[model samples]
Target chain A: MTATKEHVTIKGNKDGLVFLFNDHCEFPDLLSELQYKLEKSHQQILSGPTIDVHIKLGERELDVQQEEEIKKLVGHHGNLLIQSIESTPKEQIEKNIHQDLKIMNGIVRSGQSIHEDAPILFMGDVNPGGMISSNGDIYVMGALRGLAHAGKNGNKDAIIAASYMRPTQLRIANIVSRSPDESANEGAYMEFAYLDEDHMQVGKISELHKVRPVALQF
Target chain B: MGEAIVVTSGKGGVGKTTSSANIGTALAILGKKVCLVDTDIGLRNLDVVMGLENRIIYDLVDVIEENCRLAQALVKDKRFEELYFLPAAQTKDKDAVQPEDIKKIIESLKPDFDYIIIDCPAGIEGGFRNAVAGADRAIVVSTPEISSVRDADRVIGLLEGANIKNPKLIINRVRPNMMKSGDMMDIDEVCAILAIDLLGVVPDDQQVIKSGNIGEPTVMNPTSNAAVAYRNIARRILGDSVPLMNLDGKKGVFNKLKKIMGIG
Candidate 1:
């Protein structure tokens, strides 16, 4: 009932008792704090009957090992029934953002048009004159020598990445750009294209990690 | 069952009819019963290329429409006894027949012939669909030009979509001199763009044009360079691993002579 706990905090609601874990806290410290708080409150909270304990991890991805540790720590009291482990708003949004990714496994030949509402992962080459349009980001595992239009639904944050970026034309949001007359060196160097301000910018994939936005920091 | 192959090119004037005529004729001369079907409809040209235009008593539409028997519509070749030609309907358009009708006609001929070659019309329209409907295999033709190669790529995509696995490529009208001067694309360049197995390469030979004018396929003339290329392609079609012909023209001969003389 102490709200001053640094890493873990406990509260009661109409549904059940809720445990909130801070994402930035260390895992061992959080586990100890949870164990101490649950044991101290067990007698008072479980006086009537066993109540459901809903564990919420804010903005933190939980691995199986950490989840098992938390479950063991909470189950030590034997006076609570663990309802569910809920993710933070940030983690939930991240999961939902990538759930619509579509993966295709074939060459996109000339005159072929591919349309997608979500992100796309192509495992083959996009030959010249072929086109791909997506509302989300696009990632090509092979060469991209065609036209790629990302952020088709006005999402300025969408990006296009490819192993060999030699597209004839690239469009991000409302911006458009064409490939240069002379191509770069022919190698398996990965490249990416994204909208910077109002213009489309092309750069090496390694450089993208340095200047990514907060939402796409990972 | 006999294999039914379709020769197709999405763009016009890429030598689909000529390749079909030569390939069919060469196969027939090799003692295999071959029948060439012209599915170009109103733009029929295979009969003239095969030199059987005068002998066309009935057309493909007649056989499909049940106006004439299938055997009566087939024109016998004058040179090769095993070779036969089915002329297209010049008066009617591509709508004269459906894909199912062509499939049915090709199925009927499968038992009598060892190879049934279909000459598809240019463009990915109804005529092209009908020509490819009955084919178990496909051969895409292209030239060195960018437009032709682009169209060939589209046709290859369509063929793959139609479930014709591993369709072969034929680079026709290739000029070695132009390729050497960097004015035209080489066989390797075309193959790289198309990403398909190359069946053969036919050099731009005057003999092929002359043979076409005379209504005789160049494969009939053994001395012609194109004839040798066609024969090699036909051998490859019969599951023979024939090496590609050296179509580098005079430049390749000069290189060999320079190597013999040990001159820089």
Candidate 2:
């Protein structure tokens, strides 16, 4: 080997060890260098408690198999733990803002229908014969006496919540459920409808945080 | 110019004609020049209800077609002071007159009367549209029954879509005994569902059917509960702050007596 090139540089910060791989070098050369560096530091890593290691690929596009290979190589060192793998120049992703959350205010009376492709927050009563459907979650701040269909676009994770949970019918994705013949005294409590393993289930709004942690991202 | 009020109900037999005739008569009784226009062409009954069927030489279609002038078609109601009646043509259907024709007729009548009450035909069809064409205000009539209330709600939605905002609600034929027994929806329940301002609530009184049979409006009867309710509604239309009549007073007393007898 003509003077060994520094294809991988390891540094320690408050967060953990950072492995900055050189982009100009060949990917195989970079991976081998990273393995060598981690092995060399194996003794040094054992001296202390397990430390988090972060891998940073600068402008290097790695396939999923290559990334897994790198992760397995890093895992070979017992004391060295990989916390995260990131690319400096990430791929661009466009998020639609309108499909995130929509707010509306009014009484949806009989013969009126409201449809949306995104999550909706309605702040009024939905009388009998009125309908509200959405591709995502449906949140009503008032009495929901009419029909509400959530996850209409086949999003099974969608939910329906209301202050007064007396809906005539509730639909989520492919599941359909109707109100009981005698409306049970749900008692003015806030309630939500969600899909549980292909079955429609109704639960109190208080338990929504744990049931769907990702839905509480906002 | 005077205001043109459209009395409409989507379902038939919910007392749209009766409510229109009584409200118009009550307004006349209040010393206002009221003109009642029957827009239920081909199924005309306002004339018969108003007892002016014998005087209908010219009809709404005749006035719209320019065969007769507006004044020539208006039949004067000599019993009520300054009340006029315009009968619908029994031969011509609802399509005979367009919304513009009704607008023109109403505009002409607005200059001479304090109120131009248009009696809209049942259902949300061409006749209903024609009746509501030139109205400045709307009164949506509904009964306590579920079907009637549902139809009323649909009609209200249509009226709002037509840019007629804040249409007042009149709950007709409310049987207090049934409401007390939980068999019928109460006034508050109806109001909550409709979500509109309560113009008035008329109780279900046998006197109403009797008066209708005699071609006399229930408002003309001083002892009838519906007449008092209609009079109050008329007063409300005139911007008077009148309290709602005690709907439960008589029924509450009867309920108390029944409970004492262990018969309720």
Candidate 1 lDDT, tens digit per residue, A55-154? 8998888899999999887776677889999876675677775667888878788989898887898888888889988998888888887899998989
Best by DockQ: 2
List TM-scores of chain B, every candidate: 0.94, 0.94
For model 1, residues B1-264, the per-residue Cα lDDT tens digits are 789999998999999999999999999989999999999999999988888888889999999889999999999997887998899999999998999999999999999999999999999999999999999999999999989998998998899999999999999998888998877888887887788999999988899999999999999999988899999999999999977776655457677786466552
Shift of residue B174 alpha carbon in model 1, Å:
0.7
Query: Any runs in candidate 2 off by more than 4 Å, and if so which?
Result: A1-99, A183-188, A216-218, B249-264
Question: Ten consecutive residues with minimal summed lDDT in candidate 1 chain A?
Answer: A209-218
Q: Interface root mean square deviation of every model, in Å?
A: 0.8, 0.6
lDDT of each prediction vs. the true structure?
0.88, 0.89
